[model samples]
Target chain A: MKHAFLDEYSGLQSPMHRLDPRAKLVGLVALVVICVSTPPDLYAAFAAYLGLELILVLISRLPWKHVLGRMLIVLPFILVVAVFLPFFNKGGGSYNLGPFTVSAHGLLVLWNVAIKSTVSVLAVILLSSTTPFPELLKGLEKLRVPRLLTTIMSFMYRYIFVLSDELQRMRRARDSRGWSGKWLWQAKVIGHMIAALFLRSYERGERVYAAMLARGYDGGLRTIYLYDFGAVELGFVALVTLFPLAARLLAVG
Target chain B: MHIPDGFLNSGVSIATGVVAAGAVGYGLYKAREELDEKSVPMLALCAAFVFAAQMLNFPVAGGTSGHFLGGILAAVLLGPWLGSLVIALVLLVQCLGFADGGLTALGANVFNMAVIGTILSYYFFYGIKALLPKSRTAFLAATGAVAWLSVMLASGAAAVELAVSGTTPLSVTLPAMLGVHAIIGVGEAVITVLVVGTVLAVRPDLVKTYGYQPPVPRFEEAEVNQ
Candidate 1:
């Protein structure tokens, strides 16, 4: 029932955390766009990008272990998609590694996928780790995102843990009833559990609606609107912008 | 599966971004009719339930386990627009809050899993449901099979996006993605069927498939014309 998978280090105080969430959002988007647009063969630009990300990570005061650990979630997919690229690509001038021929261009493709994904993911990790989810949503709302989308996310953030706790209780109850069998046989029970959850959620929805109405709740969701923006945030955004630009120019030259 | 940033080229990413934005925009316009003051909470809660449900993992065969993608289940329960909207919200949170998907590649992730996955599964489930008898068993079976197919197609869509971006060759990426997803599809089928069957047992009315008009009988030509 206990989940800290989101914005775990948001409580930490640092320059990155203190910057306006919109700044982080916009800055990170620019960072990703820049990193993704760079050619893979430009190893120097990649290093500079990594350095830029590292500088931000260090400033953010998030644990390196946590940031690197999150990479595991994205790594396997990249490996699955790119691992064979080196072998399957029949580009001319390839080296023989084992039975399969690993092409130079193939290696470049692998490098492109791996490095670019890593850099962008790292930038994301830094951003999410530093910015709290609610502020992030507010930042998005500030940036002209659809109000409906933001409201939906607001509820998701609030009730995700509640529903997960309910799911946990249901699981415990099932386990307590000696509900142990191969899924092939016990699939029926799982199905019932899912149904029960849906029904419970539906009923809960009705109840929540009643409560909101009793309190004269309007349909719209509104959060207090103030993000502290000063010299530090602007300077931070400026540096993030400049680093990518400088790296690309150097990579091109 | 979440597509990471830079795995896709800029051109493909932008294209998918445009497509995804249009789909979500359309979904919003459509979903607004379904969402009201009372139903909005319910809808949001359903999205939360989906978020929670996605975390419940079941063993596939190995020590590894696969969680239900929830696209088809949501589509079957709450029409495709609401379903896609909920899944898109979930994907958005995972991308921003947990860094589960890429920021730049968020469009591709939503397009593949939410828009494509939910809409495609809904239509497929509808088609299969029409052919089968109007019974609970047929409904569950249709849901299971279509859920499996939906995941495979979504993965193929992602693979194609990657291929178009020149990230990987189509011949290599398409087969690889589909092959692994074929295994995942089995898990998706089992879980989707199990959940639909359970729900049908408890509250028959909650099954969205049942609320729609019955498929016209192929043998009864006169009834259809009337």
Candidate 2:
């Protein structure tokens, strides 16, 4: 039940950490959109975008290993998608690379997916590392995302740990009963465990509702005001937006 | 598989995004009618349970391990509407909080895993449940089969989206995704059957199929959840 820190680096003190969560949210989306929109041939722009990400990473002072590890999680999936692009893309000029006739445009598509996904995934890692989950949800709420969605997200974050603990206990109980699931028939027991977990969760949900009802949970949920973006935060937002635009303008299309 | 940004073009992203938003909006509207004040926490908690369960890697044949997708299980344990909404919200947390998936590509991801996963799985369960014998064993087998098929179908949906996005050609992407997911489907089915089967055996009332009741709690003596 050890909690993984999706926002592990959020508590660190730095300029990036201090920026308003909404600004960061909008800025991160802008970063991804700008990166994705840039043409594949714009290598210089891609390089500059990566540079911006590196600078943000340096400012946040998160462990390089951690950020790199996070990027690696999706790198393989992106690679899988990019791996086939060079082969099936029929519209491009062809080149003999030892055996396979690789298309030039296909190569460009590969480069497009590789570099863009790297930068985009990096930007996402930057956003998650910089902003705490609660603040991130509050940011979304402030940006006028539906109240119901935000409330669910908040509850999700809180209860994920408790439920994981329950799961671990079930696993331990199963192990104690000498069930290791080597045989196909063992799925029967695992089925029972999942059912047990669901029942417990259902019961817990009802209890949670009754408690909420006690405190007057009117159909809608509301949160008090606590976040504000100052002049400096606004400037940070402008910088993130402008950097990508600058790269787009400067990088040869 | 969680698709990142830049893999999809704007046209495809916007199209899927609109579909996803429309589904979410409809889900919220329906949930308001279907859910009592008590149901909201349950929905959120079940969503969190899915999140937690996903982290638990169960070892399959040979040496590799696989995680639970939980779309079918969620749809069966709760109804389809809430189940899909639960999964969609889980995607939001993963995308925004964990950066596991891209923000711009959220729509496509949700469309593939949540919308397609729940709707397809629920109907498959219903169709299969009708054909099977009226026994707990038959029900568990049907649930497992649906879970396995749900993964394949969801992956197929993603493959189509990727092909449509021109990220890769349909000829190449479809078979590749389907082949890889066919293996992942085994794990999904096993987990779903095990968990759902156990719940049915112990407390049939909690299983949320059309006929079975979900064991309403007696709230006369309300105790706070600690």
Model 2: colliding residue pairs:
A190-B194, A191-B194, A191-B195, A191-B198, A192-B198, A194-B195, A195-B195, A195-B199
Per-residue lDDT of A15-123 in model 2, one digit per residue for the tens? Answer: 8888888888888888889998988887888889999889999988889998998888667777777786777787768888898888887788788877877888888
Candidate 1's docking class is medium
Angstrom error at residue A125, model 1? 1.2
Best by lDDT: 1
Q: Which candidate ranks first by TM-score, i.e. highest?
A: 1
For model 1 the TM-score comes to 0.93
lDDT of 1: 0.82
Give the per-residue lDDT of model 1 (tens digit) for A21-75. Answer: 9888887788888888888878998899899889888888889899889877788
Interface RMSD of each candidate, angstroms, one decimal: 1.8, 2.0
In candidate 1, what are the lDDT values of residues B1-226, reduced to their tens digit? Answer: 7998878877878888888888888877776766665546877788888888888777665356677788999898888887888788788888987778888899999999887899877888899989999887788888888899999989999989988888799998898899999988888888788777777666767767667454575764555544
RMSD each, Å: 5.6, 5.7
